[model samples]
Target: MKPHIVMISPALANANNGNWQTASRWANFLRQRHAVTILPSNDPETWSSIDKPDLLVALHARRSAAAMEALRERYPDVPSIVVLTGTDLYRDIHVDTSAQLNLQHAGRLVVLQEAGLQELAPAWREKACVIHQSAPSLKPIGAACKSRMPRFEVCMIGHLRAEKDPATFMQAAALLTSPGIRLTHIGGALDAELAAMAEATAAAHSHYRWLGSLAHDDVLHHLRRCHLMVLTSRMEGGANVIIEALMCGVPVLASNISGNRGMLGEDYEGYFAVGDSAALAQAIARAAADSVFYKRLAEQCQARAFLFTPEREEAAVQQLVDNMLNSKSTNRNPFP
Candidate 1:
């Protein structure tokens, strides 16, 4: 018999964000061997309709705290998995009582990257595990298709939020001296002031274009076509975009945060200091001007592609669910 599992995500399809993507992907993975249902919110009424899931996987600690706490109280035998987000690890756990409480209440804790383990308190460390997100490989465009794009096109994918540090990308765009290097940014303007900054920067710089919020399929197409990708987040639990870029054989220039470093190995050469526009500009110039350096970055990223394969992720999800189900102490009627 298959275990019945429920995944609670704070983000829905409309959000088009990482948390939603992760929830959707995991549900797909688990469905092959288990019965899976995904819920947008963790409200008690929503969960009560399902009676009780064999296991509960909640994304975002603070956001889903109420559902996780209530479910744990009502069904103490059911195992709960709490997936930590970038904010939870970098900010919320340090200050938010609810997030901290979620950690204590969880049966198992999941961190998206290795560096996230460092953020957890000692008591929770033993139960926590790192699961690197996966993205399917998209074949790069052929030379004929590539010829249509400008000389060196770099794409950045992230919404306009303070933590994403789009300001640094805009500053780097202004500092870039190479006409051949064109920058394209794709994401929604979550903040009005930041949206204004993107518009102003695009207007001032001939090579810069801000293409705000794109469909997921469109984003993957752009990723395969671009010569390089950039991630400027100040913090990340693990970026799915980085995985997508690597799987597509595209190199990346990321901020030197633990999340980026944890995905791209510490030895990976393409890095710029967080929020440092000058350093980012220099790195972009180097990547565009030097063919050998660009090749090295691509090769290094390709070497890590095996780590994010679908088969590995699927197996990991299956094992976690099986372990949780087998360990359930109380007897209950099996799902049909």
Candidate 2:
């Protein structure tokens, strides 16, 4: 019989966030070799109804803490894996007891990016491994194909939350001087104030439009149609949007943070300091106005594209699980 695996996720398909995307994709990948089931972290009652899984995979250290604890209490020998997110790595783990405890209890820890490994404690680093996210490649749509008016379209993907730093994107839009340059924001407003700000920005900037909560395929379609994508997040545990943008052949202008640095190497020319709207605006203008610079950014993103392939991620995940199950000792680290 195939080993049964239970995955806990804080967000579901309805949320349309990075956590749900990771959980959904990983579950699909693991299901090829194992019997996999995904349970929402919010639903504790449902967790108890199912039989104990051979292995437990929980996304988010703090949100899934209760589920991890319950599984540990019921089946102490069942090895658990904790996948840390932006909040867990950059915020929660530093101050939240549950988040820290989850790291201590997990038999294996997974960080989406290499830089994320640095956030882990020295002791916990033994079992930690990096699993970069993946997205299917889409044919790039040139600007001419997207619009006949010779317009340069840029997009920012992520919900309107303080962590995502939508304000920077909005401010950059306001600073843009080129009438031919259009900015599109795709994501629902998670914070009311941010939503109001988005509304106000859209109203003030004729070139900027905020389209709330597009479907996944629609978002990707919109993404591929754009010349560039901007990521202004204050923190990220390896953003799936970056992978999606690269896969769609769209270059990125990202905030200079460890997570973005990990995705686009340290030397990538497209980084602006975190929360620096002026810098972001300048980078955007440069990419739109300078074809040579834009090409370099595209090439750099393509160079890193191999790391985010679905095949590579699936193989890594399968290998990690196989290693964990085959080992007789729980302390044996699965990742080399």
- Over 216-284, each residue of candidate 2 has an lDDT whose tens digit, in order, gives 999998998899999999999899999999998899999999999998989999999998999888888
**Which candidate number has the best TM-score?**
2
Which pairs of residues collide in candidate 1?
187-213
Q: Candidate 2 has what TM-score?
A: 0.96
lDDT of 1 at 198: 98
For candidate 1, which ten residues in a row score worst on lDDT?
A: 327-336
lDDT for 99 in candidate 2 is 87
Taken over the whole model, the C-alpha lDDT of each candidate is: 0.86, 0.90
RMSD of 1: 3.3
Tens digit of per-residue lDDT, candidate 1, span 1-336:
777888888988988999999998999988888898887664668866677778999999988888777777878778788999778788888899999998887878888888889889888888888888899878867636765666788999999999899999999999999778889999999999999999999999988999999999999988888888999999998998999999888899999998898899989999999999999888898988787998899889989899898888878777776766766744432211
Weakest 10 consecutive residues, lDDT, candidate 2? 327-336
